[model samples]
Target chain A: MPERVARRTWPVHAVLVVGALVMVAPLVWEFLTSVKSFGESVRVPPTILPGTWDWSNYTKVFHSIPFGEQLLNTVLMTAGRTAGQLLLCSMAAYAFARLAFPGRDVIFMLFLSVLMVPSQLFLIPQYQIMQELGWLNSLQALIVPGVFSAFGTFLLRQFFLSLPKDLEEAAGLDGANPLRIYWHIMLPLARPGLVALGILTVLWSWNDLMWPLVVNNDPEQMTLSAGLATLKGEHFTDYPVLMAGSLLATLPVIVVFIVMQRRVLEGIAFTGSKG
Target chain B: MSNRWWKVLAAATVVVSAAACGGGGSGSDGGPVTLTYAIWDKDQQPAMEKIAQEYTKAHPNVTVKVQLTANKEYWTKLQTAVTGGSAPDVFWMNGPRIGLYAAQGVLQPLDEQISAAGADTAAYPKSLVDLYTFEGKKYGLPKDYDTIGLWYNKTLFDAAGVKHPDATWTWDDLKAAAAKLTDPAKGQYGIAAPADSQANYYNTIFQAGGTVISDDGKKSGFGDPATIEGLKFWVDLIKAGSSPTVQQMSDTEPTQLFSSGKVAMYYGGSWEANGFAKNADLTGKVDVAPLPKGKKQAVVIHGLANVAYAKSKNPEEAADFAVFASGKQAQRIQAEAGAVISAYQGTQDTWVKAHPQFNLQAFIDQVPNSVPLPRSKNTSAWTKHAEDLLLKAWTGEKDVADAAKELAKAVDEELGKEK
Candidate 1:
């Protein structure tokens, strides 16, 4: 049995290695291009390696925009969205899952209906709401609309429904309120679900381009994704500078993934099974 | 739960009312007014900032804050901002979009402001002036103009023992030079004739004595025999092995091919002057000349314009600043910075002198015969169809005449909707 398993592992490892290379090649090429000169970068049948190591491309990114401020804005936006979604979605999910209420199923259906509609349909109305609130070009404009996601509520509701009901009933018999049961019993048990949601939110917010570009116009107020976009010119873009900016912007995300990859993978696997 | 919901609703109403009240009472007279001027090109930001500073120096109470967005996202953000009633006080407008915006009444007409300031519109190119006029009202002030030219590789010409492109070159002369300059074994082409409308075919179409859209703006002119002849110019180059295949050109853009020294000549715009000058490989090897003539000496002229938003809080100030930014002094400042070819006539002399290696005057000389870029209320709608149909002709998948006729029918249908 051990020999048969060992024979099967070789082909699987071969396929996995090929898949890993295919995914990693573009990032490697981007790094290589970032170090190349403008002439070398655009050469037909492109050269694989830089002729000279030019570190100035990194410095040029800083000169082009306020990279430090953009990094801070991206971090803050992600944190705010993640925290707001976790608290709000969990509470709404608990209400729909445990507490008995009139029209509970209908309210849950209304929340799920939002997930059915495309996000593009919401852009104009959301812009008007932000304009009315006088939040255009502000960090709150980037954070507030993104905080209340119907998808997150749906995901957490599925998670809450899967938990055993015996503990909740025992807590009720002890005279504990629904909110207390939710905070003490349900949330601790839903750690894997919360982590999965948190990871997904971080990935989405970190890579989001359209909403940040639409809401914020000021360089100082823009997130990294929006700031990096300004490096592209109308007629012709300097590819080296753009690639360099993209590398710096993605470094933090890559670092976090590498450090906590096991937890992220487990969370994803757990969500996949439960879902 | 019911009480909490009510409390939340009340809080939201109070917040909304407070915001509404706070936004209404600002931008009154005698108070400091900051007018936002939005632009797209990061390369030209310093020059724009300098213009803003000069305007602010003259008007102490009025400050112009410049905002920069990437070109790809500029129109998208502008559309959203306009719909949300938060567009910039003044923003950059282009010829293709001016008709749509002006027709929609989002752009402020500058006729009254021009007369009040006594600014001379004739100082700018007449074609550019006509471009921004809608229903006999001027909606934009021409900021900078760009005309197409033949940018040649001097090194390639020298190596091939061919004389450089000159003011007197014709269609046959360009073809002959291209054949001599091409060396396929080295993976080199003489020129890169991609399916780029503004830089390539549009100029040739006019040079061949054809129009894209009629003066009435109600019909398509792509079916004209002369326009087909104009398009055939590039196709013939590819057939003669002097230019890359359309697929190859699409894979590696003509700009990249030209900049990397793989192409001997390219039909490019005057706006590329700054970019080519900064390129390490192109700086010494490149120069410009008049676009080789066909049946007529014609080039397509397009430009940027500064237009005030009709819904701007400070409409008067925004219109005045828009005029001031495109005036002779500001244009000269822009020219001196090599940001663009200023639209103000005679100020181009400084621009010509800014970079002496290239014959920049070739672009200015074409202005006399320059045709305004063909546009209508719905230019993008027809132009997108034109691009699709032209690509088929360019790739040789369809006959040029057949493609041209099909494109004309589609464009006519789109134009019919505008009425």
Candidate 2:
């Protein structure tokens, strides 16, 4: 039995190894190219290793733009969006899922309809609103618009609906109000859903390129993604510098994933299993 | 439940009112003025900042903040800002889109400001100045101009025992040298004839005495025999194994191929100087020559210009700064920094001298015979058609003439909608 199991698993392991290598190859290439000389970086039949590891490329990334400030902006923007979504989305989702409100279904459907429209459809109008609010080139511009997500509300609403009514009814008999029940009873039981939503929001906010690029222009005011974009040139780009900047910009996210990878996986799995 | 709905309505009302009342705090009277100067190239940001500092020094109360956006996103952001009525007070404008912006009343006309400052329009290249003029009114002041040249690797030339290209070299000379320089065993090509319009074919088309667009900007020149012949020059090189296949060129850009010494020659722009100068391997080995002559001596020239937003709060200040940023002093600073070839006529000498190793003067010398980059009110619409159909021809999937005819029809249709 053991021999048969080992024989069957070898092929599966081999295929998995190949798939993993394919996924990792580009990232490995990016790191290698970041340390290569400008000439070696673009060498035909491209070189796998650099003759000399140019450490200065990393330093050049810092000098070219305010990497430190942009990183901080990215962190703050992500945190703000995640916090705002968790509080606002949970409240709205609870009201939709449990409360007996007039036109409740219609309002919820109206909110869900936003998910059908493309994000780009809102760009012009949102930009105009941001301009009117004098928020262009501000950190608030990056955080505020991203905070309210209809998808988050929808996800949490489904999670809330799945919860047993006995806990809420017991809390109600104990003289707990809807807000108190949501905060103390329902939210604790809905931990997996909240974690899933929070993780998704963080990832989306972290990697968002177009919105940040459009909203902010100053290097100091920009997020890491937008700041890294400035390294590209119109006609010619220095691939080494760009790669180095990108590696540095994505390092924090990679580190976060490494530390909280199990939670991220569980959250993703929870969503997938439910779907 | 009703209370919750009322709370949501109240929050919505607050957001809407805030948006409606939130005025962008710019262009106030008498206090210190901070003007945003939006640019695309981070490579030239230092020189731009220096120019801004100088402007602020002269006008102490006015502060110019230089905002750098990447080239790919710059236009999209600009379009959004313009439509939203909140564009930067002053921003960089390119040739092809100037007409569109001016027609849409997004860019303020610079004619009155130019006259008031006594700025010599003749100081800049005539082609550039004419390129920015829309409906007989100038809307932009030329900042920096770039022209194409034949950049070659001297080590490869020496290895192949081929003589170096010079000013007097002709089309046949280039072809012969390409044939000699190509080495299939080494996986090296003599040249990279990518289907890039600006660096490769457009100059050749003009040199062959064909115009990309009619003077009236109402017709496409791709259908013309001379234009097809010019395009075929690259195609023939590809066929002869002297240039990379279209697929190869696309996979790895021609610029990368040339920089890595995989290709011996590249028809590139003046903007490549900074990138090449920074590369350690190609430092002494690379130099540029005037593009080899075809039926005539011609190269394509284009430049950026500084234009004020039409709805800027401080219109006068924005217009003045726009003109100042493109004036002789700023151009000199830009040239000395080796950022670009200044559009001002007399400032190019400094730019040529900035890079002594390469013969950068070949670009300046071609100014007399240089044709302005072909543009219309909607250049991108037609340019997109050219790219798609020309790719088919370059890939050998379709005949060049057939592709050119289809491209011409599409371009003509786009142009016909311009007015």
Mind giving the per-residue lDDT tens digits that candidate 2 earns over B299-403? 999999999998988898899999999999999999998868999879999999988999999999999999999999988999999899999999899999899
TM-score for chain A of every candidate model?
0.96, 0.96
Write candidate 1's Cα lDDT for A54-90 as tens digits.
8799999999989999998898788777777777888
**Residue A7 lDDT, candidate 1, scale 0-100:** 100
**Model 2 interface RMSD, one decimal:** 5.6
DockQ of each: 0.39, 0.39
RMSD of each: 3.9, 3.9
Chain B TM-score in each of the candidates = 0.94, 0.94
Docking class of 2: acceptable
lDDT of 1 by residue, B1-419 (tens): 33553464465445333431212233756678888899998878889999999999988888888888899999999999999988999999999999889988898999999999899998989889999888999999999999999999999899989999999999999999999989988888899988888899999899899879998999999999999898889888888899999989878889889878789999999988887876776768899999999998989899999999999999999999999999988999999988589999879999998888789999999889898888998899999998999899888899889999999999999999995
Residue B90 error for model 1, in Å?
0.5
| Candidate 1 error regions (>4 Å) | A1-7, A271-275, B1-25
